[model samples]
Target: MFNRFWSRFFSSESSDESTTSTKNSKPDDKNSGSETEMTETSNEIDFQLMPTGLKKLLNKVDLSHPPGLAGDICEDLATLEYRALPNLRPAAAMMILSSVARQIENPPYKLNLYVISTALTASGKEAHQNYLKQALMDLGLDSKLHDTPRSDKTIMFDLLYSEGCSIYVLDEGHVLFRTALSSRASTFEKNMADLLLQLKTAKQYRLSGNLKREVQEQLIARLEKADKKKSNTAFQPEDKEKLKNLLELTNECIYDPFVNLISYSVPQNVAFLFSKKEIETGLLGRIIFVRGPSKRAPLRGHDKVVRPSKDISERLKAISTENLPTESLAARTTLHTIKEYLECDENRNHGMYGAIFARGYEQIRVVATLLALESKEIDQSMVIYAFKQFLNSLHECETHLSTQSKTSIEESQKLVELKVREYSERHGSGSFGVIRNNIFKCSAPIRKLENNQKDFLSNTLQKFADLGVLIKVGNNQYLHKSCISAKKLNTAKKQST
Candidate 1:
């Protein structure tokens, strides 16, 4: 029903805008249709002609009687024209909503989203991040907020500290992930990406550090100390038993870790972040991309953000990890259907469309849960609004990637050959003891990296070994032709002399 209403609303709105020229002329009674016919014509709405995206949806919403703080906060940002794009404000708001609301217990899956927003530099990404930070601080939920990552372990520590959920809203966060795309990408970057993926779907991820062993050791020391001081009131018989039991359970790590990362970056930088491998691994599909305009957006003269409604503030304040609303069966079914439909597109067709749709149904439900607030059941209106955000996000991501050229990607692929040549030069033997840092030891420039070189920096070397230009010396290393027979090399030099 909401879909029909949306379709008709857009159709009627378009007609009104297009028919403005007819208003000045006299009405033609003969052409004017009956009221029933007019209603039928409006009902026969062409969905293809309907204008979509969050801005159009924002314009139609009335936030007085708020569904939840998510939509209301978006409306507030939109009203102030918060110097962010039409979609980014809500993306931030949803991040806040999901982060704060994650404390809500018993959802179909975790309520948090892996969302990324991008725009041109000086396009207010930083300013918007500050605004979001201030908003979170205003609600007294500052602990959940984190800055850019200093190390790979920083996120794990953040999740450990913030009750298993941390929100990092970094302005140029893509730079960290971009390193993982390079051939020289460190284990740390790859591990970071892997850790994020684990945090996304799996509940109760265990920390492998000495946290458990250290706690157990401490517990044992306390027990032995209590035994040494039999009279000490600190360790009674019952307390000893409790301490022993606690020692048994100290092997625990993060249980139900809710980690949320919302990054804002430009399109070019983001292009280097994900490749086809990342897509197949489900990382690309899991991420929600909200792309802003190619240029900065103009401010609406208001220097400050309009404060959100009292209910929104109060509602946000009242949200706790243990007090979130539970999802209804109707909500679950709709979300499941959405997931299947998106997965179908992914299986049948191709591209990053499935990537956005990968989280589509789940994200929509998360938004709906925000809009529904205390009303746990999913409704048609809430689904429509939530779907609007999803479609806008999809459109933004698709449009953003569309701007990335195939020529540039072809160029990135050329790095493989460069890396291979680089490997041969750095490890191969040369006549002089000096290292020719910029020299290519290989006579021919290959178009791709070999398997050994790609992983262990030895890519395929058997062909060179077969040609006698190089010899396989085990451990994925190659003995240079000069190294194979220094006597022959010296004799050749002697002949030249």
Candidate 2:
């Protein structure tokens, strides 16, 4: 039966079969040329490995198992490690399930794989249904299939608890799973919020078996620690204001599911459209935000022209599966590290990660996760370069990067002037205010101030006072030249004598 399924699958060839065959036949003719081309291409493709230092740091983590049932569970868990493979979704799923099943002690628990499709089909006549059936059979789990559709919750739960079923697979499941889980008569916004929340929670908690419960407990503990840290700090008024704004932005992104807002919109508009209350609550912080190319954007030359390349796709599939466990652990570690980093006021001033989060939250997270995974396996410089490239890609989609650069330059200049004036006033013999005003005349560039006359005047006056040329004796009243250098006074006295 397996042989029949495999042969049927491979025999049904697409139009590219002839091209593939021709390429295989001519392999020797261009072997040397292609090999050189491939080497250059391989060098060009960016593949950052983990740093040795990071690897040594990670090695300190104790991955060893404990005794008894705990040990047994850990041992069982080890067999279920299936990394995601490229361009081989069905095969990857099959491998993951098979590994999971092998770890179990009792064979009585049935595993049913439920594959969901986004397309609507009225009957079994749909080609997709046949395709799914074939895929299941190819995986050698055709007998485990439940004939009933998953749209019905009662049927789903029953199948889940049923003694005959063990593993369930859902293919192309976004719409179907979302619709089934949604509350009847709920607003689309509410449904989306519910869906995202459920997915996040499930991703954190759900596993092949009892491990789900253990993972949930660990998550709860982590949350508790985070909550305690938040409670310990008292925010200043400015900090409080910023936090309030950030929270409101987060809420809008997370809860508001208006199709127009969620599907395709500018980040600023998306942030502004959210309800003010939602932003204050910080619900958006929970989301894995992503900023990718818009569907409407024109394809680049590289993307627009594509030739059949099975070898490329196959190689990607193989590469994708190489570091699954490492990637997963790295993702968790990176998230926690980022959270800590963002919480610090000093680190916030650094602004690289913050800028990425503001523009491309999801992409930054993915890049950070990948970097964490590779931190141990690659050179430090290579890892840093890869991270910079990831950040650059995110920055390219948004205008924030240019703005940040300008702001940094302006702030640095202001700091330099302020520091020089402060030092001169403290020790120099000249009138501090006069020196400050002269310095301002020499160095202070004109600013295009709008609706801030009072602030502008205040800053100007402060600069003079810092230089010791002027002193404010009363409200809005200034005393100039309170004291002059002793050299000038001595010369006047000597001339009079």
Candidate 3:
């Protein structure tokens, strides 16, 4: 059922290439102008390689291709290869690998991939360590992947001294983004930023190997002391200057060390998970969104479900390697293409696309992430699609959940009315309020006593009240007007005549 929904949701759309570019470029590029140039380089390379692999994958998968590439165009395609296949881990991994590859191919300015997400932990750092080892092994790269579980300071020191370690993958990237924003000088983010600044100003410092350590330690201590003093009171002008200096230093030292980071989750999940400030600072943009169907709902009772000739794990590994992109350009292109397809359907109010389309706030983060992955020149059309897909998913969840809630509410209302009527018949009209209050003690509507009792009560007393058969006294008190007739002597005298 979900497959059918997703198909109709994604398949029925046509997207124009020109339209895609316009919609994906809203985020402010705060990075220096040089960063923009690097992104352009990345885009040029990606556009060249994307079509062949994309066409092949589209043909292999049953899903509909983005509009304009009809079935006929895709049919003849054989094996399409994503460039970063061997190194591509998940969507996030691809983003990092692609960025690094782009930098290697076109250098002079350093590139950084910031992997920002909600949380990070060192408890299972070994798993990532092993994964990196396996990744290096698979690539046949003659390098040992070290599992460095050191303090941020030590790591920075190691990075400074380590020669030929051009790619520094900061696993659990969200931590760094958080630190960068932290006000505390002693925080890892501040320290890391400081280290980067030192690296950039290497020529300025001109210290020998051992002297570099002393200078770094001295600088870190000075920053820490300054941060502590600021914590006690408002940041004095000097302190503020120092903080800004530290930031600038960090930025300079990093020299654009290719910082590749990625996170695997739904776009909304990432948005809700990260702070607004982080998203604004392009931290969110660096993330690459990789989406796949939940494994919980596997296809069942199909002939294809039978044991495959190859090992399932091997098949999955092969598929992941085959479909994944090795370079940033390819990854960004794939993301852009998929985003376009999702948005096209969403604009037309097709399937879950509407849910994503309607949620504008989350859409921003999703689009920003895509833009970051695409080297920060996302088309406006892409942003619209991100929103549309987000809204579409939200709409589906809301529709299903709301329908159940409505049904339950209706049932409860019926039950409440039935109980109110039964209580009224057993007790009496004057006691309607008391009965209702007792029956629905916690219910605000019943407790408020605003509605006419006649709707829920069928007894003659209630019916009479509805027909003006009762007189309302002070304090919501009611008395049957017919009782007054017997007491009136004029009425009695008239009857006798």
Candidate 4:
């Protein structure tokens, strides 16, 4: 019955958009007797003028009431905007919604989304991050927030080892992931990407580190302590149990990690770096990209400083700790909605599109759950609003990428190669160490780095070789042809003098 209602409603909406196309194309009244025959012929030969199913579905949505949590976050962002901060109101709000969804237990689908928000530099990415940090702090979730994107090792060792879930708010994560997938991406970046994929899809991920040495050391220390205690008292069963549990920590090999990654970056630098293959990986599809509204100039003044109110802070604190509805009505609604989304997009026919539809279905359900709040059932209106928001995100990402040209990318690469070659000629010899130092000194020319500069330089130089900027002469040794040209020019000038 629900499907029937939506189908009828959408059909009517599509009909409305398709109205004049058919009427305007119809033949004149003089041929009225043969109108039926002409119409049939046109129907057979003419293209269908109906609005796309997805567009009509999105158009029917009422976005007035976003999920309570998301709405409140947006309001907080507005407060920041009033204070003259670079405002990413929409992006901040969606990220908060994604964070809330991460904490949900036994969700019908994975509620965690790899969210990215893109804005131009000085457009408030930093200020927006600060606002989000303050909001999370108000909710007593400040401990869960991380400034940098963690490697798979750190993620496992720090949060997942003890806590089941964590929310990492990383700045420039678009750079991290994009660089990781680029031609010169480092192993650490690749590992981080791989680990994220594993956690997203699998219920449990295998640990890669060795535990045997640590376990042996712990056992030895415990035995020595027990022997020392032997002189004072008898060995207790509890002591044996304590040792057993300690041993178990090393023996434990699998972990269930629920991590929500909210990343902020510049659109041009990050989003454009993604290739078709990356999108096909299903990882890119999992991301909902929110492009901030552009501001021609930065806002300034003491009058613009709007602090978060006590009421907003208290509300956020209350919601973070409140018990959500136990009923599965919202989850069921989400499942049904996902089914409809997939079915409706059947004619779209592309792997990336299908992946996106699946990911959006999950994201919408997450947003719906955040909106559900204390309500036992998810509202149909809220789910539709969330779905519409996802569509908007998809549109933004597609439009941004579509606007970029291959020539521009090639030109950018050429600039990077020239800068690298120039740096090598000025300061580096053929040795890796000297070349690496040169790369660091001129690192300002590099767009992105993972964790630190050293690894980035190494990976970048390797990429330069791959791009034919340098030829590898020996292990960890590279020679740039430009360096030779510079040397010859210097010798010629000396001879002329």
Candidate 5:
């Protein structure tokens, strides 16, 4: 049953790809700039994943090959042997856009994004991110790449010390959320939710006043060294300039701190990560959730890697922070269109999800700004393409994060129901001893229930009894109707035989 749901849910994911695959090989990537198109009225299946507003917005823009730098990047990654996995292609493309966007001067808006990827354990969720990192390192753009920061004050510390942008990768995202739940979490980690919210549109980062002491101490040491060389003379001209600059920076404002956050995790981590608080506070709404394939990739023969073509190499090398591309009129108009549609949730009608769609409006606008700054082409294709990806993320939030998102609670409920029925079948009665002492075959989700486990179980059982599936027979016992019927059928079968 689980496998069937996975197939139906993800059937369209692979339907767009080519069939040239074999067993024991990596995933395939046959998508091109040409369209695997979708229309506004197209309801491909009962489980259509695209949100209504985004789907309607698609009707206004072309759904063919992505235009400009974003499209070129998809092909570039494929050429570099980073073939698109289930949900990896779009994510890698977004990273490429982010890498270039971080370099430009972010005055009108910040292009920073927070991407959250969820997949099965060992399903290779980090494959595309790793591949993109390796490509950037090979291309000399690795200056912006880094692991997570040491502390909150030091979040953009490395970028400040260095002369480039920053993108932090958190490979073990599950551990991150687990720690967020801890009362002893670090100040920086605890502030992650707020940081993500503020940074999305922030134009400056307040310099930590405490950082001044370190700068002051360093300057003092530098002057002392220079004085020792001259023995009673003041510092050298170079030393004086260095000290002066260091002290000035401590007071300087960190404007346009372009930082991107990427994380990978399994489906089980969603509860600990988002929770009711994160959702209500708009943190989860800010994150772009990229879900990997429902089922494992088809096994195919391993192939040897190949060097990227010269055209792709030169294109990647051309990307730099030295200059910003001109924003296209069409792209700008499309962004405004998206803004108008999502703002105040006027036509979106997403209910409680309106806030999230509005946040996605901000995200898409940033992408349009970045792609324009990278491609310099006056086209709405990239803007349309970005909306396409955002639609998928929104659908994921609705299906996985909203309904049936709490696997722990679901597991406990299912276990209690199954055990009650089983016990009634054998002893013709219902008691707490059945589920209470049945921990021998318990799973992780069962043990992860809230503090009031006994009360929760009692409430659940009572709800089932009220529905007629279970009947109260005594002070602490109930009879499962389905189990009794099954037992009677078996007895009748035995007598007939």
Candidate 6:
């Protein structure tokens, strides 16, 4: 019965791609600017020359073409009018991986594939995001996914106590990065980054901080929902006791948060947000950056609603989600295979490749995810698939970052400060939030800032206040400092001369 079901699932996925690929296909770009550039860049990487054991494994698996879960998801997402890097499929697979994560215990680290996708505006970044979310929903795992987290403390609490496996998708990941780099980042920002770093490896986390209003509201909502489903809900009396215990233990901590994250950001000025210090410290190293398509496929208007093939729904229903034992010899063998690649000097020297190379075992974790999904032993093929996905993601990152517009961070800062001062002089004093918002809304050389840009502005304004460029008169409010305006001083000098 299991074999029969899986056969149907595979057939459905195959048929779905064979039928719909052309309709939602990427535009053939022989002359487009970004497309030409990307093509030239991709040509530089020799896929046939094996650089890592993972690549060797991948070549062995696909004597002809890439296959398995990642391939199927990529096909399905493409059929849905989304153009993205190959990493989208693996990143989307995280939701499925989360289910399997629940069954594994006491691993060295939790299964967390931290992904950060960067793309140009209107270049299917949003479409890629929608595709991943839809894939989860199709697998009947919508409830496992959450929006951009409100705070770090909230994530810590949810991972500890939330039912089932969880994956939080942050749309404006750059905002979080900016906050981390902020000169005066709120205590909330620092704590959240620290907590995420901890949760990445440690099974348990100590949740401090007095329970905030958000936590209280979430608990009340959970209780209300439990009452409504009293007939079938799994909220037993012990569960209630557990919730009470969890509330009290907020001061102490909780254990085994098997959580993962998927984040998306625009590439504009993102590199500037990270300092050399942050990069070397492994904060940036933890993230896997996937660059979206260099050239967006032209958007086509369609009356028909495009969707993933039925194979996805069938597999989710038919496949057993039992996580295999992590201690098994096969798992150990998989680790050794990945270790060989970790030591490769060729893989180590790639540009800004520290983030990708830092977590060498990430390939093993991803392969484990594949093994769990297939209920099969770790093999060269699975490792290959895992490495190929990372290779594509890494290639995309290098290509995109290399070609990204390089704006001087200092120049950008001066532009923002000038805009803020102008706004303050015209409108009198305003709150930091107000000043930040106004600067972000600029249309000239400043243009519109992304969410992260606005966040950086907020941080910059606070630093300005500290330096006497602005004075903080009230909470979240600031006024320009009594200093001669640069423009005025220039005019005065001209008249004196």
Give the per-residue lDDT digits (tens) of candidate 4, residues 1-497.
22233334322332433332221121110101110011121112111222355445456553322545555555555445522222245456655555655555555666666777766677546667777677666666666765565454455544432355667788877666765565676665566677777777566654545424533465668767776786555667676566656455555554446777788877676755444456667776677665553432335333544445677666554554244444356546545744564546441334335556556666776666666653445666566667766755655444444444334445655655676677666655466667666555665655443232346556656777665567654465666756657665455335434
Which is the better candidate, 2 or 4, if ranked by TM-score?
A: 4
lDDT of 2 by residue, 1-497 (tens): 22222122222212222243221122111111100011121112111222333333332221122211222222332222121111112222222323223222222211111111111122111222233344335444454454323332223222223322323333332333334334563343233343333332221212223323433354455445555566556634544444344333322322211010012123332332122222223323222222221212121122221111343223222332234223344445544443443345432332223333332233333323222221223233322322333332222222233343346446644554564445445644334345444444544342322122234434654655555434433344333332435665344334434
Candidate 6, residue 29: CA error in Å?
A: 9.0
| Candidate 4 similarity to native, TM-score | 0.59
lDDT, candidate 1, at 235: 68
After superposition, candidate 5 runs with Cα above 4 Å error: 1-13, 16-65, 82-86, 118-127, 138-140, 209-248, 266-271, 296-309, 319-337, 344-352, 403-462, 468-497
TM-score of each: 0.59, 0.25, 0.32, 0.59, 0.65, 0.59
Q: What global local distance difference test value does model 6 have?
A: 0.55
Q: Candidate 3 residues 1-497, lDDT tens each?
A: 33333333333222212122112111110101110011121111122222344433432322211111111111111011111111112222322233323333223222333332211122122233334334434443213222322334554444443322323344544354345446864554455544443442132233335434554665677667767776566657676565455434543433333223333223233333233233333333233232222211111232222121233223223322122112345445665654554345333243322333323343333333432332334433333333343433343333333344446445555555555445445543445466445565645554333343344423433554465444443345444444344555345334434
Model 2 lDDT on a 0 to 1 scale: 0.30
Q: List the global CA lDDT of all models.
A: 0.56, 0.30, 0.35, 0.54, 0.57, 0.55
Clashing pairs in 5: 22-300, 23-299, 23-300, 24-299, 24-300, 25-299, 25-300, 33-65
- For model 6, residues 1-497, the per-residue Cα lDDT tens digits are 22222222221232333433322334321112232133233214333234444433443332112345545655566555444343344456554545545555555456666777665577555655666666567766676777665466667556646552567777877776677557688776666677677666666666444535456556667767767776775878777766676556555545676567777776664665444355555665566655544456566454334445678657655555444433346546655655555546644544345545656566556545554555445544555555555554454444444444233446667887788778877887788878877887763545433442455666777778666677654455666654346675445335434
How many collisions per candidate?
Answer: 8, 37, 39, 3, 8, 1
| Candidate 5, residue 468: lDDT | 57
Best by lDDT: 5
When 1 and 2 are scored with TM-score, the better candidate is 1
Q: Over the stretch 39-85, how does candidate 1's per-residue lDDT look in tens digits?
A: 22221222333334433544453211124556566655555443545
Can you write out model 5's per-residue Cα lDDT over 59-118, one digit (the tens) per residue?
A: 443222345665555555443332234355456566666665666664455667788877
Per-residue error for 416 in candidate 1, Å, reads 15
